[model samples]
Target: MDDGCNQVNPSAALIDLRPVTVLDSITELQTADRHKVAVTGSHGGLASGRHALAHGVAAVIFNDAGVGLNGAGTRSLADLDRWGVPAAVVSHLSARIGDGRDTMRSGVVSACNGTAQALGVRPGHSCLAAVAALRTSAAHAQETDTAGFASASGQVGPHHVVILDSASLIGPDAAGSVAVTGSHGGLPGRRAARALKHPARFAAFNDAGVGKDQAGIARLEVLDSQGVPAVTVRHDSAEIGDGSSTLRSGVVSYANSLAIRSGARAGASLIEVIRRLPE
Candidate 1:
């Protein structure tokens, strides 16, 4: 059966729709090839994220918004960084922008929804610049095709991070944005960091505070402590989802406000975020 991404067996890749469950079906996906891999499941959170990191798949396509967009999803991005794998997230959320803007986009990486936007860096800029430019980016992607694995959850890579959120999950007042960072190649000179239109610090994190995204920061902090450089996004929505309770518009709005604030606060220490990424 050809699934949306032309999968030979979509069922084989699908994980159970439960909490605290991991996908054993695609465990060997990394060893198979480095092609774009999409992981879909109701409970594809921390456990599944670890598996994806172990496999070191080229890109991760999350089917569910919660799985790869929230706390667990951020951890997955950190894991990918540790493995030196470029990652991309796709979802129905808005992009993260530096100018305190939360815009929305449909298919491609939107300013309000893109990783760079989340970091607050202007488009076509370096990775480090983006993170420094903006305080934080929030939300996860909902659905669509774009560079990397974009989900309503979020996406990260060697030089990029993006977040998207759904109106239902967050709220109407919730803003969307996109963030981008340009590669500085290596050790950026003070002048270079300032002059280069876009200079990105290697995404890394280093902190024990637990930060905002649950276990996600652990990995980034580990790396940031070593000065690997990093960037991150965090968003709070009124209604994350209606796992047991139904999601509502009001709930979503409140949730998004919290998430955006959290992301903004965290954006300041992007390098530290990468250093703290999981090992």
Candidate 2:
């Protein structure tokens, strides 16, 4: 089977590169029949890949953003494969395009999905090359089955803390408890904000790239404005280890370490940080 989509225009040949703030915006371009591709500033997580697949873009590019735990990279690749869309991810540093919306266009490819690879898209290639490759390859039939690509949800944990690897993991059971996640601080689209609306006492996220533009601190502000008491720890810290490590061991270690360093006992609940906030 050809790994390209009928919607792709080989003659158009031009790579329509545009910067998108969040994964959801990619849907807006779906209505166009032109040979278009999207450069998204978001991480190459499963949610991002799902959006790209759903929108039926010829191709998409994202930042690897360290490809943190719980097989985030693997999940993204799987999504593109199932959807038959070509995709690539660039390093976080190369993600600086122009202003906020334009940043996605500036990165170099660090990784690519199987479809993308078959089209000559590979790591070390410019994102433009990836998109160009997509335009020339056979367009894949659009996928209608989306069951396997559904967003992630939450899981219960000890001490009423909800441990999740993605913001999509936020669920009804998490209400009135603290939520700890390996997901990036950035909540890209309304889906993310809506998922988090459940009445949790607080949330914690890995401060992906710390204060980098469009990432860590930017996302933290988004959560704060929504009236969610959220805190962030470094992505590389023991608190937010790769998802393979048990949350009980990694997340708990991070929380306790944070508390002790802040003049509280190890294992203190994140609610303590909330209490210290100004009324």
Give the range of the ten consecutive residues with the poorest summed lDDT in model 2.
238-247
Backbone collisions counted per model: 119, 10
Tens-digit lDDT string for candidate 1 (110-223): 122233232333323322222222212222222322223222323333323322221112222212222212111111111222211222233211111121123223323332
Query: Cα RMSD (Å) per model?
Result: 20.4, 7.7
lDDT (0-100) at residue 191 of candidate 2? 37
List the global CA lDDT of all models: 0.26, 0.51
Instruction: Give me the runs in candidate 2 sitting further than 4 Å from their true place.
Output: 1-36, 96-100, 148-175, 187-199, 209-214, 221-227, 233-279
Cα lDDT over the full model 2: 0.51
In angstroms, what RMSD does candidate 1 have relative to the true structure? 20.4
Could you tell me the TM-score of candidate 2?
0.59
Top-lDDT structure, candidate number: 2
Once fitted onto the true fold, the runs of candidate 1 whose alpha carbons sit more than 4 angstroms away are 1-31, 34-44, 63-70, 93-279
TM-score, every prediction: 0.24, 0.59
As for candidate 2, its clashing pairs are: 4-138, 4-139, 4-140, 5-139, 5-140, 69-243, 70-243, 97-103, 153-169, 154-169
